[model samples]
Target: MPCPPAVRPGTPQWARCRAMYTSEETAALLGFSDGGVDEVLINEAHWTMRNLLLEQLDERAQMLTGRHKSLSMVEGVQHDDVDGIAFIGYHAGAGMEGVLAHTYLANSITGVWVNDVRASEGLLNSHVVAEYGVPVVLVTGDDLACEDALGYAPGALKVAVKDHVSRYAAVCRTPTRTAADIRAAAREAAALATRHQPVRGGPFTVELEFDAEHLAMASTVVPGVRRSGERKVAYTSETMYEGIRTFKAVTTIASAAVEEQYG
Candidate 1:
């Protein structure tokens, strides 16, 4: 059958296309029967954890397929209509133990912390959504990833489809096993679907510690970001909204300075 209509451009529907499937699975898990699930498919980005094949997706989904979204992976969480989020295909943060572990720019960042909590992209985005009053209801990844979720999303359901041996290897489940697990978890997570009052936990202080000093030095070019020590940069903002944006800028600058072989 033909895919569901593409999310309309320049509208909130477009934004819905970019939420992680974990959110959709949460909606499904929690019994959101009234059009609550939307799927965003990113293209051409192969870090193994990404590159979701649209054709293989179940019929209940509507996919946003293409490239260059402003917020990238967690694109839809900011929308007022989105109630909760889920982190599907999510691994551990860079420097943490999991399969295909890394944060935003893959290998460039060694670690990121918000209010001193080590953050995965899921964890960071979870904090971002909390500012908007959205709950993370489900998370799926390796065993370590599920453990990580407990620290950030304690109430959320988690399914570990694999056991991590390294960044590139895992004791993986068959697709049949994993898919059933995801579907069941998605169904249950839907019950947690409900928005609450927006949070304003600002001024948020974010600290980034990179593997190299040059990366930290490069991040300092962004105004208000300053070196905290040899390989770390710190920045504060009035809100997590602003804090995350500044964090994005710092990562971008740091990523650009990475040497091909030395970094």
Candidate 2:
């Protein structure tokens, strides 16, 4: 209903995460709103690749993800080197009412918690960036997504490109209007990208609840992860960095264990 009651705020610091396009390094792109990314001159490659990635994940969850063969999100960027980050096209966490609501997996994971706080990708990522003093400066998505951002990035600029009607439907704005809205928000958001002291909130107890009992059992393959209940598993990480990586592992294993029609 409401953005996970009193979820602990993570990385609320301000910092600059510059999105440099082809030739112009200063030109800012507002990013995705509603179902698709707002078509921008620089968004062509990014948008296409994003769709491809999503298709791959949805089609082949068992094949593994960034944490494996290819560069993962965590390994791709130097968290310490980043000044800030942007969470564009975010949605509510799994089990919440929002567009295509799910955590890392499509439908396997029912919930994710950090320090026992029900967390969305934005919240989990905000904590990751916070470890290196990177503040989340801009978050764009549906109205609920914008509302979710308030808990994690209270200072970051928010733009709701659409109003959620159902998991698959929304009252979307014209591409023209959304682009303009995101552009203005991005401009202001850039100024909020001022880095602050790195947060060392650790000893995090990361937990995941799955739809099937076997998925929970499968997650135990990861080191230090153990079943906390009938359909839930939990792990402890000293840092959010490791926490995310482990979470990724758990999801990968659990998804790989999925049956075609049953899962």
Candidate 3:
């Protein structure tokens, strides 16, 4: 899919930015026609300053837009036909330095771990896709985000569009400069796109540490979830697919339990 072209403030530009870059630099590298891909867009955020810049996509690509998807942001990766996945407009995880850093939920999750490593969304999704033998071909974001990708997908190409200073700020590159870098990187990344062995790492035990006691207690509403400590809950599953689904349920319940004034 072509990356969104219109860069907006405080939003991750994932595919949009990548599309701009690929159009300019990497179009020939991946052996894809200059403009031949489809985009499935999802609006997982509450608000943004500008709409995605769709105009930048080459004539060969098409887009899907709107919100409320079953898989949330990565709705397209699971499709059997998708050859590779790209992490675009990504950022550092919660408590890390990068623009708009957070996991699935901005304030609810304190941390998420994958195979005992501190994970950002890119890392988590990388593991999820690996289960289906999908390659993560390109990652674009702040420098730290690229660094995070290295832990999960070292073989993929990376494009660092900015240098992190704080959660909400960065020393950013202009769209023009970043586009050039991303295009070139993506072309090479495309070469790494072949899928490999499907990985199965489980019976996984997921532990979620909430910021408050009530949040932990609330998570127990999920059938197998249990409070493991004063402010922590844990659940076990036979596969990461089930593990992640259960983790999602726990987060949903915990988030609803949060009180505005005290939590």
User: Which lDDT tens digits does candidate 2 get at residues 56-98?
Assistant: 1222111122225221443433435545556656788888888
Of candidates 2 and 1, the better by lDDT: 1
**CA lDDT of 160 in candidate 2?**
83
- What TM-score do all the candidates reach, one by one? 0.79, 0.75, 0.78
- After superposition, the stretches of candidate 2 with alpha carbons farther than 4 Å from their true spots are 1-79
* Number of the top lDDT candidate: 1
What is the RMSD, in Å, between candidate 3 and the native fold over all Cα?
5.8
Q: Evaluated with TM-score, which candidate comes out highest? A: 1
Candidate structures ordered by TM-score, highest first:
1, 3, 2
Predicted structure 1, TM vs. truth: 0.79
Across residues 1-263, which tens digit of lDDT does each residue of candidate 1 receive?
11122222334543454343434343343333332445422222222223334554545555544445444556666767677777776779977988767777666677888778788887777777888888888788899999999988899989898999976678988665676777777777777767888877777778888888898999988999999889999988887767767877887788778887752
lDDT of each: 0.70, 0.64, 0.65
In angstroms, the error of model 2 at 261 is 3.4
Comparing candidate 1 with candidate 3, which one achieves the higher lDDT? 1
Q: What number of clashing residue pairs does each candidate have, in the order they appear?
A: 14, 6, 12
Q: Candidate 2 overall Cα lDDT vs. reference?
A: 0.64
Q: Which portions of model 1 miss their true places by more than 4 Å?
A: 1-50, 65-68, 261-263
